[model samples]
Target chain A: MKQLFVLDDKKRTSPIKVLLNVLLVCILLVAVFWLSLSAINVTFDFSFLGNFQVRIWQGFLMTVFLSLASLILSLIVGVLSAVGQNSKILFFRYLCNIYVGFIRGTPLIMQIYLFFYIVGTAWGIENRFIAGVIILSVFEGAYIAEIIRGSLLSIDDSQLEAAKAVGFTKMQTTRYVILPQLVARTLPALTGQFASIIKDSSLLSMIAVIELTQTMREISATTFKLFECYLFLGILYLCLTLPISFISKRLEGAFNYEN
Target chain B: MKIEFYGLVKQFDDDRVILKSIDFCDDIHTLAIIGPSGGGKSTLLRIIGGLILPTAGEIYVDGEKVSADENELQKYRKNIGYVFQQGGLFRHMTAIENITVPLIKVHGYSKEQAEERAGELLGRFGLLEEGHKRPAALSGGQQQRVAIARAIAAKPKMLLLDEPTSALDPEYTTEVLDIIHELKQQGIDFIIVTHEMGFARHACDKVAFLCDGQLMEYGESSRLFNQPETEQFRTFLGKLLEWNV
Candidate 1:
């Protein structure tokens, strides 16, 4: 007989075990949260939710809009940069490298402040919402480019050699072979990146863009309900991200057969 | 086919020369390049196929110079088929699509024309029933056959086989080799890099023995195998053939 602690394929999961584990986890989380709340001598009051309902909904919509816009623009930027890194022109290749390096190396908060105040001002980008979308796209595009470029690089050299051997032009190879692979390999990560873009858009609050966090910030500042506002803000963001994360996971499972 | 090289060289680094001062002018059909591991056989074949450029020198097939420029090389590569050891079929494509995509995209065949040609080749290779399957779904031997079908889909002037059966077992190796022999019988001229000494001796018209980045011997296959010129090649043959049953 195998030891009790050993993992065995024959030892299948049971419904009761699953239910018990989930219940225990929920109880542990609530117990810890309750103990912390009592220790801090904090009493929650969510009555201000009635007054700021409209503003909160508007903020949520703005966050959604900002995320959607950023996701698309960043996807374009990501694909271009990923392809650029493989360019024959040294200038184009280095430009992609430096762009990805600068964005990934720096903190997002610093990027928001720098791009919004300095670069946006210099470029005469006066609209905060547009500036926020552009800033978020630029920030997230670097990470997406890395995700795409990694998949691009992981494609075997032999695949390319075979394409060349068959007389494919650069454009034809990209169309027939490389693009299909890039899509199959990067779809899950790109969907997951949408969730990250939504979360990252919250940083635009620093520049007074009325995304979810900014609206919550104003309400909490006025009503003196900081904990309640932030807690509700987290829940609101989760509502937006949870479905996207679930889709990303499903895509990951679906694409596992390509290998 | 006549393969002529003028001072051919390939260097990956300052000192890491893969092919060093290769000088050969040969007029032969059905050539096989046999060499020790890492002896630059595949690199030489790739250079000839225009898949890669040599550091310095030129390859002349039928007295026509193969350009080293990436853009110009495409014109040369289109006329030559290359089979890699791993089959190198596009992982996402079915066996038939692997053949047809190149025909339609590179050769400008209509979809019907490409598919018809691909179906004929797959049938000839005895893969008609399996043509709809992806490369991953096929066995190693089947994948290599699909790769071969993909290679010759557009009727390349000459085919380059780079250790095409190295990854297969004895049975699958025979299946791939049998198809290759049938291709030769159909007058599809080819140059192969292989370790099958018996196949190289019996099937090929010319044999070039490469070792340590140099062509150690080159001659008619039967004569060279029986009477290798270099002392090094003789010792090499002894070690290779000693345990053969």
Candidate 2:
């Protein structure tokens, strides 16, 4: 049995600090809840939400559509860029490095602006969904590339050497041996990247996509109930994200090496 | 039917020559190359396996010159199976998948036949129980055994091993050597680079010594181990024996 020394030691590292932390968290929650209730004029009536559900449903569908489209684009870009980044030849690495650097170094907001206003107008593609999809995918692709490259790098060198020794052509080695492990190892990161994309989809409201946040904005403006609309919007966001977080956590646990 | 190297020279970047004028021929059952570190022993094996070409020299496998035509060397390579120091099992693949990769990728075997043969070979090696496990989940000895099984799964004519048992424990090393001996009984030729002098003395049909990319000595294993000829070979054994003593 392990000793309870850490719990017993109270001077520098005590349970008091933990108690204080919980107390602070409770106090912050109470303050926020109180402000929200008073500001929204709490009336215990959810009738507005009943009428609002239809628009919310449509907006949620659009959000899903945008997220799925962006995710597919991001995956393609991420994989290609990662392969390019780790290419044996120097020129390919340089090309991938410059692309990743240019995308990641700039702010996502600037990228959105470039896609929505500059490129979208020039190309005459006025579909906000298309512009939003392109912007989010390009932005998220940079981050996904790093995650993929990291997973690929983590693979053992002996693995590739073994494939070669077994008389696998380079393409065969990658297709059969390297790719399967790469996909498995990067799954959790893929989920995290998808979650980030969902959250960032709120940025589409600026371009008038009428996603959930936009619907909430329209409701709050009309009702003059900023706190109520946002409170419900927060609940909707939680409903979407909580399941993703729970599933990803379960995946991580299931695949954990318990040895 | 014969492989010989004449005036073979290899250098990494024109500065440090790893192998120089290595000249030898081996038509024996199991020929072992044993030498100290950085002695270009593995370089000789790699060149023989046709994984790398010598910067200057001629290598003939079965009377076909390797350096004369690049395409000819590739055809010769299909007959050789090289095993690395590490088992080098692909982590993503189970034992069966790893074993059958050569058949599917190189020999164009149908997946069903390849998998069936893989299962049979793995069963022969007493690894059927672990056929579904990935390399990461397997023990070092088991992974190496699986590697050996995979190497021979395609039924190559010659096996080239580079320090196959160096990373294994003493017991595992004996197990691997036992497998090699069993393969020798079936008349499969092997060019092994290893540091296990005991195996070199007992199991090998012939032994070759390499130093600074040169063939120091080559003879029957019993004669070479008992009565080493060259001064360099004698001195090398003297130091190794001192360590063992």
Candidate 3:
């Protein structure tokens, strides 16, 4: 089977070799941190983490929930938008193009601010969590739409012709022929997008969403352990993102249809 | 079943004509359309199968006029089976699933019924053991056989083939032609667009010669092959015959 990760293993690193390299890096990092602490005359203490552990855990849970909800909404929006973009009707195609253009061209932070300050205010929505999800979904949805459109278009034209020639209705063709192939082709990209979504959830801190980053900010301010709080936040993000990356790699391997 | 094409004209960008004012009718069970490359043979077949809309033309299948409406076209298409130059089998589906999908999904056959029918078709094509293999895993010949099996699974009134064996090696070509011949013996109507002049002569009841987006000749296979009237057809057949030799 072809390897999915595309990493060249011609210069194969042995397990012991990799372990030694990791240990060397870890030692170097530790040395640098120790020197920095000494230079600042600050004692490195992680005891402050325990004081705000529950609050941080709550924030972590909130981030996960927000990401999950936004992921689902974004996928729905992406699919609908992709279909709209690829629609035979000129107006629908242009409409989707403009939407993807506007969302993608603007900064995510700006879009979030616009949604929170303008759209949310106009709609009289006071729930910050809901607003955060909406913002993330719309922002991520644009990227997902482009990913889906690219993936769908990448499929050979003959596939659709075959489906139609086989007497499948347009919807049936999409449901049976297009969607299955589309899902397989788009999954790796979707997983990458999902990891981005999880990391970008940190941006919700600006809106007082009390997510992981927000919690880290509060902890750092109260306990005066900015470095430790930020480090923990970075580790938390890796915890969220690495599994998605690993699973997507595995899925790419499994769905390697060509091979 | 009878099929007719009246004043069929397919043009692109208002000037590039692919098929120009083709008027032909045939009631034969197997009609072979032979032409040079880019001669509009496949385009005519596609137009006849309702896969492509003619820029200007009317098609009648078994006395029923084909329409542009999606529902009507789908209904019309259900009665016709089309096999592409490439097998065009779904890459994700196994041969059995490829054959059975339309049976279960379009014809509303029960899963068991669809599978049984698929098994029977695969068995008939000497591909029973290969049913679980996807298109990429199958040989070129095996893929074409599965494609034909899938096309015929619904027992369509007419089968349209667009250069069905064009992509195959000689061995696979012979294999596919043999299957097509067998299917014809079973009284399945076919309109095959092919470069296989020998097969067209031997297997087809009628033959149409198209060139430069025009129907040069249309008549019984024996007459058209033996005594082609037009200079263009003679030149086309001369090249084909020289190539075959």
* Pairs of colliding residues, candidate 3: none
Deviation (Å) of A98 in candidate 1: 4.7
User: Among these predicted structures, which one has the highest DockQ?
Assistant: 3
Q: How high is the lDDT of residue B127 in model 1?
A: 94
In model 2, state the lDDT of residue B120.
90
Q: Is the docking of candidate 1 incorrect, acceptable, medium or high quality?
A: medium
Share of reference contacts found in each model: 0.79, 0.51, 0.64
DockQ of each: 0.63, 0.39, 0.67
Error of 2 at B232 (Å): 3.2
In model 1, which regions exceed 4 Å deviation?
A: A1-20, A38-51, A79-99, B6-27, B55-58, B126-129
Residue lDDT tens for model 1, B120-224: 988988999998888888989999999999888888889899999989999899999999999989999999999999889988999999998999999999999
Give one digit per residue, the lDDT tens place, for model 2 in B122-186.
78777889998877787777877888887787789889999999898887887788888888888
Q: Which ten residues in a row have the lowest lDDT in candidate 2 chain B?
A: B67-76
DockQ of 2: 0.39
- Candidate topping TM-score: 3
lDDT of candidate 1 over A67-148, digit per residue (tens): 9999999999998998899899999999999999999999999999999889999999999999999999999999999999
**TM-score for chain A, prediction 2:** 0.81
